[model samples]
Target: MPDLLVGLVVLVGAVVQGAAGYGMNLVAVPLVALIDPRFLPVPLLLIASAHGLLALVREYGDTDWSGVGWAMLGRVPGTALGVLAVATLAERPFSVVVGAAVLACVVLSVLSWRPRPTRGPLLVAGVASGAFSTAASIGGPPIALLYQHSPGPTIRATLAATFGLGTLLSLAGLGVGGQVHLTHFVFAAWLLPFLLAGFLLSGPARRFLDGGRMRVAVLTISGASALALLVRAAVG
Candidate 1:
């Protein structure tokens, strides 16, 4: 039952991410954690990595390598910090912190305070993304906000590239920290089919979600999911 629930959550998250360029972790991490905390960080990172690879292939030409490089540079230190946090913090407190940060980012983005994707801002976003991603497996809003004004394809492709690489980095850090075990891979294998299904469905959904109004929907979904994470953490 837990596996089925986790699969369903990933399926939906994949579709959201596929269409919006980012959101799978925002949508899936909190929900999956609710079902089974063991499915976090590593397994979800693996699934998200696969989804990001597909997005990068589909929109390869649109990727901005310079921007990706800037973000990755920041990710290095941020990833180290995140690993330290995950090792130190308790589960519920970690969830609370991550949820609060995500909600704050969503609110800032919704207020039309987008920062241009310049070198400094991109680096900052990358660092924040890396920290949050490694700690909570919810890293997308920081980079997504920086590129909110970009073309849909560019946003999707660049984010895909960033996340694909970032997730791998996080996974490595987790492995070294002893946060990843063989069971995480087993769970990821079980959920792979659903993740692929969501990715496939995203192709059709993207046509409708690639418009200006889609930003509103994306923010709404992000905010709601963040709130859900907060509520769950508080109740627990």
Candidate 2:
């Protein structure tokens, strides 16, 4: 891809990541996929690793470390399993399964079907999110569900920390598998300026969002992406 186009993608992605702790994948992967779909998993993980570290720093003192730790317990094994799945599975089938799961969340939400408000349910969601995120780099839906029970900053902090660790694992795995290259790191390095700028702009916006409204918006975006994936999967 041309440098200008790549810059454009990075810019948009940075903004999305700025506004939401998790948009690096949501914003960049689709556009990058259009250019070279197989590159999706690698760049998404790298960009996510960058944003994850940024979030950890910005939200440091305010983070709920206990929650982050608990989520990681499930995430570690979940991610390992997810990465294995990605290694073994075909892209189209995997995308379809994830798409369908996301669509189910959308449908349930629209119908006013509340997520089961039990600890067991939340744990299950956490595990699912970890696995899917590790595999597809699109793990926001499960996290979105979990965050509905939290305030905005807490939600952002927890997600940033959890995804930060997950993305770290992903990058390491990709490196071991020879899926990521120095060129990709260079690309990501060049894009860091926009990522920082986005985070700066997002700080104030994030502070102003009503806690309840932010939770709802996060779920809605996740749901919309799932719907798009469903269409892509079905048609393709």
Backbone clashes for every candidate come to 0, 0
Against the true structure, candidate 2 has what lDDT?
A: 0.69
Q: Candidate 1: lDDT of 30? A: 66
TM-score on alpha carbons, each prediction: 0.88, 0.85
Model 2 over residues 1-236: C-alpha lDDT tens digits?
Answer: 55546556766766655555566666676677776554456655676677778877877776777766666677777777787787899766887899788778767776686664245654666677777886665777776665665667667777788778867876787788788877777767766776677677777667666434676667767876677666666777
Segments in model 1 whose C-alpha atoms lie over 4 Å from true places: 88-105
User: Which one is best on lDDT?
Assistant: 1
| Candidate 2 global TM-score | 0.85
